[model samples]
Target chain A: MLKENKKELESDVIQLVPQLTLDCVIFGFHDSSLKVLLLKWKGTEFYSLAGGTVRQSESLDKAAERVLMERTGLDKIFLRQFHTFGNVERYDREKIKKMLAHLIDPDLWYERAISVGYYALVDYMKVFPNPDALSDACEWWDLNEVPALLFDHEEILEKALHALRLELSFQPIGLNLLPEKFTMPDMMRMYEAILNKKIDPRNFQKKILKSGIVIKLNEVKRGVAHKSPFLYKFDPEKYEEVLREGGLFFI
Target chain B: MLKENKKELESDVIQLVPQLTLDCVIFGFHDSSLKVLLLKWKGTEFYSLAGGTVRQSESLDKAAERVLMERTGLDKIFLRQFHTFGNVERYDREKIKKMLAHLIDPDLWYERAISVGYYALVDYMKVFPNPDALSDACEWWDLNEVPALLFDHEEILEKALHALRLELSFQPIGLNLLPEKFTMPDMMRMYEAILNKKIDPRNFQKKILKSGIVIKLNEVKRGVAHKSPFLYKFDPEKYEEVLREGGLFFI
Candidate 1:
């Protein structure tokens, strides 16, 4: 019954002008550091986040996946829609009018585009990202070292970071950043990196241990400390359940 | 600087299909009731919530306001965008493709239309609704009495209700539903209506009092069989601050 309606909607979308695009805020943790994926635009000093337009035949989710694959070379990862950016001034139409007064045709200069923001958490080591035709370089920037970004991209990145922090408050995240089995210090470092704060070591361990989401492994760290920290692995099943129940683990 | 980009985006949208619709889930509280504004389509048995298409040169938010005003004769009420219903199946094209196969051209039937969902909170008694050209009647249905709605409207309403409930948990809402000054019972009834459950009277009162977002009016209800409940009014400044801080108050 719903299939027929879907077909009609697909046909309708094909007939309309393609004004929608998907902008991704891809976050990755590496070397106990928080980073975001960005593309340095070719021929310009500006860098932008990895993003692309939605195809007529694709769902918004599919479009986001396509963008992720094309930009990051990652086939599948954890990606979710966070919000849509649609303020009238978001596109900054007034400035465009003056800049393109003579260089570009006026008719082609002003095009209204609304973008859906998608945030993805991925294993940084697994993906090999390549810049598209319009970009010079595609790379990960430490959250603290972000350069000037184009088209409200900075604002978009900030929103994604805020959402990620909130998600961390409840979910057992940053697992993507670690190996299958990791030490407590490794996990704590990831938290400290993303939070950009020095947490009390004793208190942090106590809070996380009480949450019961993490399971301690008999294996210990291999090197570099007076006493090796115990290895831990996140229980995905329990982590998901807690997320579904809207539970939060305070730091 | 951003204005030029916005102009380009706007022009791009115009090149797309012409139909841009605004659908609203207008919620009202009456007689300890929680209700939603809905409409009956003119030629079909399918009932729907109040909605309409946007005119050329009109902003999406303005389109929502216009649709709200045209249907309910209410202005300056609190309205917010919850989600954009742009799934390819939004229009039920396959049914239309089969049902109007002979009468309507397939090209016309597939014309893309994007509808934005906005939920509004208004005083039920203040509205004087008149159905639009596509609808037979405009009416309010108790939240519990919602029938099968047309298109993806049921899903839209569910999402809106979820957002509303989340909003209620953090903010002292439903001020628009009450008179200038209302008794504690009136406030409690509204809370129960939105929460959709019987709450312990003592606990509910205690929780609300502790939040300190509401002010006691000193006046009391006059025409009740039991002792008159003290009147209360929401402190707008405090309520705003609570909402800003993401404060939670559970009943």
Candidate 2:
């Protein structure tokens, strides 16, 4: 696998854009916690976001989708281009050499590159992680527990989380991160996890209910001590309309 | 001037990242209308937004700011990156050749490129437009009267405007487009121009007042015939705080 990847990299360098790349901060929600998928570099302890270079034949967005699919095996998820990181200091030559090491030729690497950062929201249980050619393992790490990342990935991940939280104010993002049917507390918990702060449960419930994008189901979520909260699911039409018209105010 | 510009371009090409560029949609509100700053290409009837390439030495944002300053002569204005356009069809070889006709070398031109789109808001009266080397003139155009632009610049402008409208819901953008002291009617008019829709004056006033980012002054404008409206100005500290904390909801 290593030899094939090195050969492919040597030849494909001409086909790929030398100074442009895309990185994904894939976030998942499970076990009442917010998590991010990270890749463990081959023969190194450093972890980084799943990312790859753009091919000359593909669009930037297509490249991002390809990266997400290659690492998570999940297609058609809610992937958003949040921000592009192009600080000159982000490209440390020594760091790049250490990260790529034996996988790529030293001469093929460019000294400076710009990364377009994207963030994806996926269901935790559905994703089966797959490492790319240069990585040995792919897995989920709780947001706080994530190890030191390669390059400026730590900054990229922070900005992605910030973008997600800001998006919650005016978009129905819960639909992408939460299950099809969830209790009000469950929804609140997901919001709490993303925001990384405590939200007033009553305030959150009131806002979500007033938005009219979610529908209250007759069935209840069982097995919570003595209380069984009513389960609710998104009204797909209303959710679509709200997303189109842009005024959900879900925070 | 043309020879000097050509020489500069020839020398600067190697300094810029060949496949990446930045474009700006500079929006200004005046005369009860929204205006965009556009450049008329040298010796051609085409217009395009103020834009430039990312230098290897500078970051993406620095490149955008440089482009904005070179054209508008205004520094430290509200510049926000809205989107990055990288569609395969955005690059039309014949179209680009026509646009750059006599300016650039055919061999140096790239077949495919990506553009980072940015939008800026500035006081209409403050900007003194200056054309770049490839452009003959830079001037303001009413949003409705924008001419057929070069490349996919029309799409880029539309996306920037959409992003600006979306940002209005969460940020206090009036501070950038309006004067230090303005009336409620003036504020409402600017909003209407950007949103391209009439908002009920009462509802708009109510929301703005409740946001607590603007302060009412004791003096009223005396120029009006019958009834004079009180003036208001932004509470700068509060506005900055709201921007930092991220929950202004200004519609």
Candidate 2 residue lDDT tens string, A1-251: 24556576667654877688899999999988999999998888879999888888898889999998888888998989988888887947876775575776666666688899999999998899999978899999999899989888999999999888877778887777889999999998998899888989998888889888899999999889868999999998998888877786755
lDDT by residue for model 1 (B1-251), tens: 02233465456653332444667999999989999988876656668888865544556677788888998898887887766665666767777455443433455443455567888988999988788765678888999999998767898899888767756765667667777788777888888898887888888788787877789987888889998888888888887777666555563
Task: Give the Cα error of residue B180 in candidate 2, in Å.
Answer: 2.2
- Kindly report the root-mean-square deviation of model 1 from the true structure over all alpha carbons: 7.4
Model 1: DockQ score:
0.19
TM-score per candidate: 0.81, 0.91
Q: What's the CA error at residue A51 for candidate 1, in Å?
A: 1.9
Model 2 alpha-carbon miss at residue A165, Å: 1.3
Top candidate when judged by DockQ against the true structure: 2
Report iRMS values in order.
3.0, 1.0
Which ranges of candidate 1 are over 4 A from the true structure?
A1-17, A31-33, A94-110, A165-179, A182-213, A222-227, A249-251, B1-20, B54-56, B96-107, B198-203, B249-251
Global lDDT scores for all candidate models: 0.73, 0.86
